[model samples]
Target: MALGVVGASVCLLVFLAILSLDIMGFLSWKNQFPVDGKTVLLTGGSQGMGRGLGKLLAQKGANVIIVARDVKKLQAAVEYISAAAKSQTQRFHYIAADVTSEAENIRLLEEATTWNNGQTPEIVWANAGAAKPGLFLETPLETMRRQMDINYWAAVYLAHTTLKNWLYPSDASAHSTTIQAPRHFIITSSSVAWCNIAGYGTYGPAKAALRSISDSLRSELNLYNGARRSTATTTKPAPYDVKIHAVYPGSILSPGLELENQSKHPVTHELEASDPHQTEDEVAAAAIKGLERGDYMIATNWLGQLMRVSGMQGSPRDSLLWDTVGQCITSIAWLFIGPDMEGKVWNWGKKNGMPAAPKS
Candidate 1:
């Protein structure tokens, strides 16, 4: 009887895990996100994939709000996206105060909420992040701190603040029967959520933080829907409607690489290089499509999935978590180019893409 009970318990646990994965998979496949006339916010939208996403969102009729510390780039992007915004509303924009600082995060939330009238950008793309590749032994503490600040903390603070200031209120205001609401939270995550192949410690940890946030946030917010909240009062259409999505994708050689690259191979030379690479425009186009469909895990670059299926573990939970997360992240090359990708991590990159640099 004892043996039988243990077996049954194991079976139940496995079944539950499978069920969760299945549900998550379904959500990942949902590509019906509505963006007809919503205000869209994109961090790091001044250049690279973020810029591409702004153009796409503008073309989709969304008023795009681009955020980045580079004022010159931001202004240039605004001019270009405004022309591209095909929307009758015309694309809009905002200069970010520096997404990595707590004060900046707070300021960004307040300012972003007021963009496009008081509409408070229904969609938020928290794609502002930075990375520095180096060996673990050589990487300076400053480098790690900067990585955490830019890639990890900045996005975290941006999401936390914006969600509290704008999203929650919007969720409160969304009406019933509104299949696709005005608000969406899309985070550009990497394929690293599933596997770890090589050079993953530094960038890997930051990317993993995003995945954990996505899993935790999704689980919590999903509960408020009709499926779990029978007596819920927050769903009576308070002011904003929402869906939080996290996109994990493969590599997209963003426009940043055209100059950043110092390669010799044709696979590295041709514009059509299929070396798991994509342009910022391509990344943005895909991201908008994913958002439209309401996909949670948009697998833009899938190297991480390979790692996840390989069945690798790191021995200790923390070690294992980072290892798995890094492998999973570096595995994917996410290039999220969207006006409002909140909490998303874009993993797409160029050259030797695995973020193989040491974490010194």
Candidate 2:
């Protein structure tokens, strides 16, 4: 019996090793997301991860257009992105607009389409978001509404507008051409989307909603992809294949983090202390690597990946075998981690009575 158990353990180890190698791109090295010469429109590009990713895309030969609400910041970002261009001919632009409004998002897409020489951007990234962390009751209702508007509605509106243009172009010539490269739509969500802890009630749900939308779109795009394959020999095939991806990054050390810390609860700080803090560039690089690997759900760090598998809850898995292993490991770990977090919060409340009320 002991020998039988030992043999089973060795088989499991060998299987896991092979799966690990496959997941790490050692088995397949194709760059699924090649941005060279493609036009990319990224929202929230004025600062933080948005800015970092714009530079990386520019360096990779993409014509980048960054959208943000700040004209001054957008101008600076345009310059920053231009400096990183792979060649002198690569174009860079910046658009100043508030993406929270649905009407504004429609106009934003129109302007981007015009700027791209009547072609919709091949890659659109919904990276604009804000976080307002506080106890659910203490956080103002206005802040909650604003968080949903920026973090959730903005991505929804932008994706809606862009998909309409990509799938149903008004110009007849646009669809007549045979474009082999698939288009990409990326959404920026947070690790909190998967692991909603105390003190982030206002912020977590918005990101979680974004994750749901991304998953739905990822699956829905398959319909168009299948149609394209079926009509490949015909004169009029599907316009172009669409790929949806979501990025989940842990605590990033950026200007946004500074603002988030100003109102962050002490207990929240203590709880998240073990999570690795990443830089904007580090997060951007990791996200790009995941995109290249054709991963639908991209986690910027180790902790975020664990959080992703922990609460995946029937969403599509990026790697079936690898994610299943991760899910099992995280499920066991959460047995202790979840209770420990609750106990910490419980002990803090017991020690400190009630938190001081927010000032009027």
Candidate 3:
């Protein structure tokens, strides 16, 4: 028994060492998602994680364009991003518009492309979303519709518009002999997308839908990517390869979280007490690091990672072999954790009546 335990421990250590090397980019010669000198258009960039990501990208030498409904906040965010820019040449701009409108998203892309000197942004991030936590029966249908509009449909609109431009660029004929950097479409999801909690009826489904979209796009885009590699293709493929990524962040300490807390039920709070709360900058940094390392689904914290592995389903893994290993371990842990969560919620309801219903 002692020898068996020792052998298992040694094997685990070796696997971890290899996984760390892959995640840290030591196994790759070049950064997978290099943003230097690339144009990035980020929605919800006026504040919170969006603003933090804008600043970080600017520091990494990306020309950033932030979109939000608040002109004052957008201006402030542009200033923040400009200050963090690596060089004076790095540009920062802002667009004040509501992303929930499909027409507005189409116009927004046109404006951004014109501002970027007729070049479409190589990196697009759909980061504008809000959460209102409430019980399913108690939540209003209007609130659910609004959540789905901003969280799911808005991303759908943006992704459609961006991918169209990227796949058929105006200047595709001018492509150089050298391959250009691949375009990236990143979506921001929540840890609750994978792990269900009682109070997120209006919010969780939308985030999960976003994750689902990411999964579909990840596979569907492969057809286009494969076409690029074939010499027998009759038509020209996209100018560059396309990559899709989704970032799953746990509870964040930001304006959005404060707003969610206002509507979050007491029971919901207690149930999620174990989730780690990270700052906007911390989450942004971790997400960017994952992008640099070419991760498909990025988790901002340990809890988020656990949730991600729990509901991985058919989504592609960043490191297949290592991720499978991690998933096996997480699956074993979830055997206990999953039932424990259900029990806690059940006991809470028995101990206390339904949480206070929202006043109509």
Candidate 4:
């Protein structure tokens, strides 16, 4: 009876400590940013996770502008979002533009701003991505380049233009009194960025580059925000409340994932079996929820979260105490588990022949 009471007292102490941390902002317990009646620009919004996000955001009364290369898919997505909209004034627009080209991304940004009555998007979702899985030596150089272009460069271009032209524009007229909402930039990376496995040579590296870019952008934006505040004058609007969020999603049942699965080596399947794939709707919900909560890094599942904590760099800490504890646990766990997992994948690859080398 004495031991039971002691255990209960210890649990209570821990719970109260956590509560205190949350109240002190050591754990992120702040109110979520409101999305209602805001303009959101989503790329790769034609199908799969992007479409699901558009529909969900539209239901929340956001003016959603979806951009993709497929006109038919874009139109279908727009219709779906429009149909699901909560308010009669909730707007859904689509722009057919390939995000891989910097010039095209610039044009798309212009179109998005025009569609939103010259108001910049309060949220920019850089969600366009692709993957080509195969042996690194066997994969065509063109294929590797294409993957990088679509997944990494596309995000860079869009984010660059978004910041230069709208979020932190040089033109003073770009600032509008009517639309001074908090700005968010959300990018879709993959779990492979940290939890890499075999047969993902091209795709994993591309995502890793994206992770790096997002980290750098977050740092730059922080500096910019600080500078703007320090140099603020009565003549200019307050500095933009811009926040960057990077999502590291595990497998999801989307067209892109389906394509990747079709060509993925068997060893890849074994590595991923530990984490069951989520639906497009589930991923979309989690991504938006993370953004609303103002998280710097978002992961959709336990494995993704574990991998993120294990490989975490300089990303913002939502819960300092919890995140630090998780990081320590994951770091120690990965020291043994990571090697064993890699050994299994290596043995599987050795048993099965790799893809043929590309013709010289």
lDDT tens readout by residue for model 1, 153-188: 877887787666543455333333445454677787
User: Per-residue CA lDDT of candidate 4, range 43-91, in tens?
Assistant: 9998888988998898788889999998988888899888989899888
lDDT of 2 by residue, 141-161 (tens): 889999999999999999999
TM-score of each: 0.68, 0.90, 0.90, 0.88
Stretches of candidate 3 above 4 Å error? 1-26, 172-177, 354-360
Clashing pairs in 4: none
**Global lDDT of model 4:** 0.83
Please give the lDDT score at residue 135 for candidate 1: 41
| C-alpha local distance difference test of each model | 0.62, 0.90, 0.89, 0.83
Model 1 bad stretches (over 4 Å) = 1-31, 167-182, 226-241, 255-275, 302-360
- Provide the lDDT at 2 for model 2: 100
Write down the RMSD of candidate 1 (Cα, Å): 10.8
Query: Regarding lDDT, does 3 or 4 come out ahead?
Result: 3
Ranking by lDDT: 2, 3, 4, 1
Which model, 2 or 4, shows the larger lDDT?
Answer: 2
